[model samples]
Target: MMEFKRKALAIAVMVATSTLTACGGSSSSSDPDPVTPENKAPTAVTLTANTVEENAMGVEVGTLAATDADSGDTHTFTTDNASFVIDGTTLSLAADASFDFEKMASVDVDVTVTDNGGLSHTETLTINVTDLLDYYDFVSEFDAEKSSVSYSGQTARHALIAELKNYIGNGGLQSDVDNGELSSKEEIVAKLNSFYDRDENAWDGFAVTFTDAKQKFFSEISSYKSLKDKVAGNDASGQHALWNGESNEAGQYTGENIAFTGWSTWDDAPAHVPADGVIPQKTPHGLVQQFFSQIADNAMENPGGKRYIHGAEQIEANEIPVFVNYDGTDLNQLIQKFLLMAVTYSQATDDYLDENKGLATDNTGRDKGEKDYTKLEHQFDEGFGYFGAARNYLDYSDNEIAGKVKTEEDGRADWNGKHDTDGDGEIDLFSEFNFGASVNAAKRDRGSEVQTDFTKEAMDAFLAGRKLINDAAGTELTTEQMAELLEYRDAAVLTWEKAIAATVVHYINDLRGDLDKLKAGADDYSFTDLAKHFSEMKGFALGLQFNPYSKITDEQFVEINTLFKDAPVTELSEIDEYQSDLVKARDILQAALEFDADNVENW
Candidate 1:
């Protein structure tokens, strides 16, 4: 039994050891599989709002970022607003985004971030738009002034002639000469001070020369009347009647009786007298006054006569509507026209080209001393004065007239102000008139160096010509120098012509654009407001005629005249006819100036 028990115990131990070993080996295989966590949505980071200027370029609004709990997840970004764009979790304003402060101050954008697991988070981004800085308020007022200004009949040159006639008759010059007390020219000049009740300083603003031209005119007229008196022999009234053609006999007789019946009649008057009769010497001022007086007389006779005076309306046969101030204080259209005409036609064409060409080359007989300028040089200088160009106009690099403002002292805001803008020494008339056109053209063509070169060349030529005149004082020009002067003159003329043509083209385009806007109903403008635009357009068109180098033919002028004949136009379509004519005129002017009018359309 003991032997058997031992044997069984041993066997039991062996069995127990084997079972324990089996359980340990099975533990490795029986363990459950390891558990994994599920995937989660990304956490989107909060973005701050931003501010940007209007028309800003390449502005970065914010970066859109997201984090995924899942491993190896890629991120992407996008915006709902077309104004914004996104690339790989980065957000930015679009390159060509239009942000107008006037229209809208700010814009909101929705930016979304998404992970590769299909989870997206969207956040609102507010972008504040700021305004651009404005330096000057020039364009608005300039356009307003252009529309507001009024143009009327002859009130400048005609007023001047009428005042002269009235002064000669009412101011006692006629009485003094007819009584023979003021027989000599010197005596008549001495008497003029008493008539005005002031010194020669009072006449400084008058365009006409008081001392020389006035005295010479009176002297010639006095001498002619004396000759007529001698021929009539106490029947002098009949002789006056004959000279005046019996129509103007009813008016009071004075030195103002002279009229431009005919140049031949006045020249042939010595033949009417005996062999011992005195011959009258002709003076330019006298002839000009007589011609003007004839126009005044014709205006008196027919009332609505074709013989209209340049700058005044005919109140009567011998009367014109006069103004209080004659020295450019009256900013009427007639006055402006007269001033332009004085520079371009009277001084430049008549005096400089015709009457004083002799003095241009006469070195031996040059007028020197205190009165240093030659007749031709003075005439040219006078034209420049009328244009209001500074003596050293070339010193200015640009054409912007500084110090311009709305002031009563500036003569009714005719052209901003008569103040000395551009830092020149003196306040001149018409300084910014047509000169602004040239300056604006230069600015507009700044991108084209070749176009700017022409404007610069023009300015240089004008400066050189003015310098020639200024230097020619107390001396005469040599043949070479004279030729150079002429060349400079021609260059100035051509350049200014081109500048004006460019200005006209620019204005035409502007008008067309404005008309298009009106047609499209982009601007809410009334008919009255629309008329102002037409008026401004007509005003610019009228300026074309004032070009010193006029490219418009008579036929073209007639066609252009039809545009303004119906003033204060109400309809947008009303300008269509005018626009067609203007385009034609612009083409002609461009062709004359050798300018390429590309893509110029009526609309």
Candidate 2:
């Protein structure tokens, strides 16, 4: 320890003590008073460590210390810091301040130390934050159960589609006090229109009600997209791209309304559903609603064809009513599939996950009036909502989600993933229920006899993307971060598209079965069954057009439409050629989607 001292002092004294010695002899008893030393500032300030890992706890980086010029002098420290604190000679991060590697890398603080003499010294230090790039995980990053991940609005629309099917086919209106069968065609038409053009107020009230949470479906608030708002890019322009059935700039189908009456096979297939290019001007929702209204009459109306009538009838043994068009199109099946694709899948992959407009929004701040999430984060959440998977989607299996009952040790059965985990008798629609595409993904996967991980892959990508967005809470995404975001979005969107494609193939297999039953001339197998199978196939095939990132190309979709005709050919003699055409369609479908031949054949 080098000797430390205050500045040296100079003094001049006269020998007046000699002259005063005689007089001082008597007063010389008292010695000269001892002089006191001056105080000085401390130096050599430093911290033990200059780096910390992100999300560190306790934050005891190192002790801060300084050397004092005066011996036996002690020191105290303080800082005007945003993320650090000082206790006596010790240092730590402030309780309120946190280090997120993606959001910030270094914390610069000005630290001051004072000696017991009231003198002080100041120095600056930069604590580098280590980037634990893959630190975030599902359970730790998200609010324990759920946080700001609401998609009830989108789910409600899914529920509405189910209720609409019941309303049209199962006499759902007969049971509800606020709703019932219409007295006249005018009332029926008005009520049907409400399904397509309903606002938030009307939907939650009486338009579509969910008595069960398993009816799970879509995400929400201000800037929140309602089901009606997002269906087929629906807007006031009154020209929904999917409804218009117009080709994009590249001459591809825009995935408008697949509702049409047309040829099973033609050499030159047009852009829209009809071979001659006669596209309907109404929304898909509106067209299906018209079908429902026609069912209410129960009359032998042959508006669109001669073989079939627009009335409720049984398909084989089931008493549940099925509505059919003149052209062997099951109106009820078309309603269920078309709306599910048009609203839930369409909005999830096309609008909310869209690269330019949705993901590029600001993520540094929370939603304008909401604190739960940033604008970008909310949009991602909305996209996931449109996907319609429960937050705990990973916990269930394919059989479980498709409502398969479990085999107990005693050979009895019970529902899996349906029990109330929170101990409440009622279900939580967002976390407990599976809706629309989410349910179909599982059902289609399990139904195929092929193992497909559609639900898990899609949900995992959503979780990863959301984690990235949440981790970068205080700044806009960097170029690398943005690239990562797009990658995850692509994975999720592609998986969703593939699940939809698989379902189309699944229906193709069903349609072939329908063809066999008709040819067998079984009294139990009727054109009614053919109508149901064909409509579902057509509706799901049309879903391929909604996503910009669709794996199915425009040309392939055109081929599919060419293969599907205006209606099923119930004429046994003519049916062979249509069946062959369907085989060709199936070939194109499995090949384009990269599906195994066995899966397509079985599904």
Candidate 3:
């Protein structure tokens, strides 16, 4: 039993036990000397009823009462157990104490009732926690203003990816750097690095910016905790990477000893300047490092190179910025989506949600280290952050989330009263904006006429799971509760994966349309467009291997990758075969995922 704050402290005083006074003439002067009344102790204490519903904080458990012989005695109630406290005769749950019937069915508290006479009586109060099954009612953190759920690191990384993608594809920056508007080659490289590199874990220095009516997103991190040391898995040290070989959970690797062995099928295929070599990476973090350098070195070597590399660019008809390495793959698209999939999706579904990576049995009923959120809460919250939905994600329509909403519809993806939960006038990217998979889910959902509910399903599961964690406050969950948590997690993961697959199919459709335009000798036929579409298609296809729970088999996976050329299909002679291959690959995804034919074609 622990002492609570409301209980009074006892003070010791030396009383004159025997009144020594000159009372020699008392009997002669008065009938008797005034006598003090004897103090009587409280006889017994009882609790009116000791039961409270689960999920209540600081609610009354019962009424504490005492019986005493003296009519003038007023009693003060105190409890030794910190789980409860007494005010007057009412015994209520402690401020930090939340009872979960699933965790603890009952608790015994020792309560002492002290009378004004300085006499006390103690009794054991048994409290029974009643069950509540409304964990599904757990609201969004944004609606609840859950300060404890901190995962700004994930949101910051999402913003960084967006910023970096924008920077590399900027047509103005391309001509300026290539035409000497920027000072030196080293300066260009420095600028590229600055987007991802910042003050040691402070995660600052990106040029990317966003604004709603109320506030601006400057990649703020003052709201986050321990993750400040390291948030994104973009650095080589992170366990996440584009998985290169077979998907094997038991044989995870992250050190120098492993060799980059598996581009086995396309090992001999021609690349613009192969980025291959057994470059000390089996899992491909080293491959990412290689790309990080390759593009920068390409720009540094060629004073007037295209944004990402030194090459004669296949400019797009729409003139959208195209940043690609010499091999014609957009490093921006690949890296951004890669990190989104491997780091964010993998973390939400595979790493944090599972008992293996974290979210252990002991994760509940306490704060995670010095952070305000409990371990279980933080674990899922981090995953949700990486999913990159605004706190009120469901409020926005699909086109609004994809940033493709027309002006007439009054879509509220950006800063508007609809999503400005903070009401600071600007859309706070940390919580009020959508990014990464959440946006992609919206895109895939709206791209096809057959409509999917990927975003809503996943968001609902995340909310419900966190509710489960909340209900079990300050106590480890029972086996049943943990199972329930995992079930919700699985729902979110499955929907998220389906969105990714649909996205792959969506990109494939884009590539096919590009091929058709090229064959028609359409003026808008742009290799840059084809390259962009192909990169997204192949990149997401590559993503299929990252999720540990993915159903994409090795054979189906290899067949899809094998169909994708070393680069986008640039040669006109190959258009027919390449387009055929595109349908084949798309068919494989459609069959494996059981996507509707009309939806795949439309998507």
lDDT of 3 by residue, 384-431 (tens): 787788876765678777877557564643523225555555556666
Model 2: how far residue 512 lies from native, Å: 0.8
Clashing pairs in 1: 154-311, 154-312, 155-311, 155-312, 156-311, 300-317
In candidate 2 the C-alpha lDDT for residue 340 amounts to 83
lDDT of each: 0.42, 0.66, 0.65
lDDT for model 3: 0.65
Question: How do the predictions measure up, each by TM-score?
Answer: 0.38, 0.64, 0.64
Alpha carbon deviation, residue 224, candidate 1 (Å)? 26
RMSD of each: 20.4, 16.7, 19.7
* Model 2 per-residue lDDT at 247: 50
Over 4 Å off in model 2, which ranges? 1-146, 173-181, 199-204, 207-211, 214-227, 236-286, 296-322, 409-419
lDDT of 1: 0.42
Please report the candidate that would top TM-score against the real structure: 3
Candidate 2, TM-score vs. the true structure?
Answer: 0.64
